[model samples]
Target: MSANHRPREGRPAIFVTGAASGIGRACAELFARRGWFVGVYDVDTDGAQAIAATLGKDNAVAGAIDVSDADAWQRALAEFWVHSGERLDVLFNNAGILAPGSFEAVPLARHEAMLAVNVKGIINGCHCAFHYLQRSPGSRVINMASATAIYGQPELVTYSATKFAVRGFTEGLDLEWSKFGIRVSDIWPSFVKTRMAASFAQIASARALGIRLDPEDVAAAVWACAVAKPRFHKTHWTVGLQASLLAFATRIAPSALSRQVVRYLAR
Candidate 1:
């Protein structure tokens, strides 16, 4: 049976960053499938437009924004809120970059860029969308954290640190916004089979780990976080077995032991 598609007039709405591809695109599609209006925001306007088209004209809107820029985030959210009748039920800060090489091997410029997008981007999204979220009952913010955030990974040093920043930001804001009735949370997914993962496929140890998740799996978790009653109190949403296990291990194991486990996985 075909999924139930809601009419556009009275549906809830979500704004997703990095909606050009990968998990962001998947989340946009899924939200549209479930009858929510979607704002597909990405630096790649063409890619965002394509996804919006796929969701059908009535279901989606597209915008181009460099998340690293706070002003751009303001412009994007303003446009999105207008399209969504000034109602924003969710803000999925899913846009990020990963440099899957050794810290020293990756250039300084790339590390700076990663921090700008992966860390600053999320903060921009949260700040820009807070007013809209405060006005909308049950609204929430969902950031894209990573398994690497649990403990830093060697090859993905900068990227790992950025995810840690995201995790910390999500937790802090989740509490701060409680009085405003706006919830916040993040997803930690390990090795999703997206273009980003493909970029690192040549790494023997990553391949040896032999566990990969579909973008849709992470998308489903995003949806879960959005609609879960008691909302964002559960700030850590893990997307796969490995992600969940590692999250558990990090809590119980010593820091050295956890680092060893990550080293073993890399090997």
Candidate 2:
């Protein structure tokens, strides 16, 4: 570690995975600006380092992590723990991948990769960060779930499934981890204008709904969750008008009706 990048003492810290780009980068930037120590970790080592550097040496540290790999999560968090004054205020499980195509058309490997990064990644993160979160007062885990989790999206079948897994995982941990004072929450954002979203921009759902939310928009929601009072009932945070609407519909509408609505949008 460079002299300038050495950890400062006594600051709330956030460990953000997938911090090389998109929502992760945006959240890291937001929290650092708000006087929080930030750990920017991504599989893209150089990109994560670049982001950490931009956040200023004293505000941030950078590391390489492939979130699906359990061992890697341990290593990254261990390094982050040292720079963060041995405290982890928040762990943002923001790393994920998507494969948008007909279920059969998308390659099995792509689907499996999506499951690894999007679903297993969160499991690895929350499990690994359990102790750090338990030790830190008011610590939270924020998982990146998608609006597709509201209902099964046609073209985004596997991706949608992974988010549903995220939703369940978040809810379960929120309940289970409360004993340790570690609140768990997840963000549900519709299509966002990121490189990942661009890959599926031409999909039917994207064409119907249009990508409105930006990375910064979701980052703002994460910030809200990080600072919000610990309410046991309030767990999932939705971003963008469309995501909010979908989340609302899922609550009031019958399953059949909700399915029709999603089918129409995904057609």
Candidate 3:
């Protein structure tokens, strides 16, 4: 493996968005544990700094960034590059929100907020990180997509739509950035036991189905995607057994069958 593929002194670094709590926080901690300098960026500055503190002052840099704002993304990543010797090995667009309820029952503001943070967040992060990622050999982008990307859910319709947008962007960028030697990939994990998951009204189904995943599980997958070989670079990394099974089924199953399965799960 190239030195860039793993964390080394002042070289490999990862910046995680929404690093306050939940999956983003977990990703930042895992990368730090692996010896990578981590940037904890979030709208919640206190939460961001708390994560950085746990990682140790020398191991992490904390910044508050609202991912929907392109300018903020540029500024935060610029600082991150400076801290890591201008190197960026991975950019984890792990910040997102879940709004669960009937589409019309949810306020329009909530829908718009979801779009800004979940969809535009990925766009802003990838666009701003492009130059840094290009400079770092074997660099990768790991977007936090959900199983909802495979199909729409009534409760999380807006959130599902955002993930679909992320999945499309990951595929498009993977093709576009390959010439630049940057690997782009997305992850599809089922409901994880985070504050975000608990906020979902239909979260009980995951418990009923006995398929709730842990944040560390997805964190492990993020690390795997970060260092995966170019030849073995998977476009979509699915976490947990249910996600793995659904990924396989969706690829081979008919559209109608998958749609039916989605409806069943949302029940």
Candidate 4:
């Protein structure tokens, strides 16, 4: 959300990165309905504010932030606190990037950018939001993951690698942050409807390969994770049953699934 707007006063706060679109926007809207003051952060300040306004000024604040930049995270938090006069109770590390290209064909610049935004971005938000989250007795962190992280999609290997990193980062944190009384959950969404899939050609390609999740369903799970109590859940919230099935098969039959994924996606 844009920084110029005033945050609605007198409500508990939630800080969500990538609130400009898709699941982030959906989560922001839903969280507001749940009565939390939402601190919306997105690189697209205008887009973020637009969504925040829809949720009513009484429940949201929009701010510009490139979650990968440490200083940008700092500035967004400072702005959020100044506007709301409250520390964040829930933080969503949801900003990420996906650029489709073959393993060898993927551009280095986009690969780096995806890694920075998808993996490092989550890490940065966790770092910057630590103080605020710790202040709340019930604070929790929700990190976004992808079904691509479960196994390699040959054509989108670079994006998958970054998602793999997200899975690892979230898992590692769930272990490390448990003692601090913070819950960490990683959401592995298969194919959510969002602008990020522009490079994926068709949702059918994803469907034939496996499942595709809806943004609203995933957003609802994000809200559940925020309020639900669990020290750390290692299972990535595999949205769409096919996602969980593939995850299971990959675990029980790695060799066969690897060969099958290549053959299935080749269609």
**Alpha-carbon error at 255 in model 2, in Å?**
1.5
Flag the better candidate by lDDT, 1 or 2.
Answer: 2
What's the ranking of the predictions by lDDT, best on top?
Answer: 2, 1, 3, 4
lDDT score of residue 181 within candidate 2:
84
> What do the candidate models score in CA lDDT, each in turn?
0.87, 0.89, 0.85, 0.79
Candidate 3: residue 80 Cα off by (Å): 0.8
Q: State in Å the error of residue 121, model 4.
A: 0.8
Ordered from best to worst TM-score, the candidate numbers read: 2, 1, 3, 4
lDDT score, residue 14, model 4?
Answer: 83
Q: List candidate 2 stretches off by more than 4 Å.
A: 1-5
Candidate 3 lDDT over residue span 200-222, tens digit each: 55544454456578899999999
Residue 99 of model 4 has an lDDT of: 75
Q: What TM-score does prediction 4 earn?
A: 0.90
- What would the per-residue lDDT of candidate 4 be over residues 211-264, giving only the tens digit for each residue? 366678888888767766564444368877767877888888867766687467
Best candidate per lDDT, number? 2
Prediction-by-prediction clash tally: 0, 0, 0, 2
Question: What local lDDT score does residue 150 receive in model 4, on the 0 to 100 scale?
Answer: 82
The TM-score of predicted model 2 comes to 0.96
Off by over 4 Å in 1: 1-7, 202-205
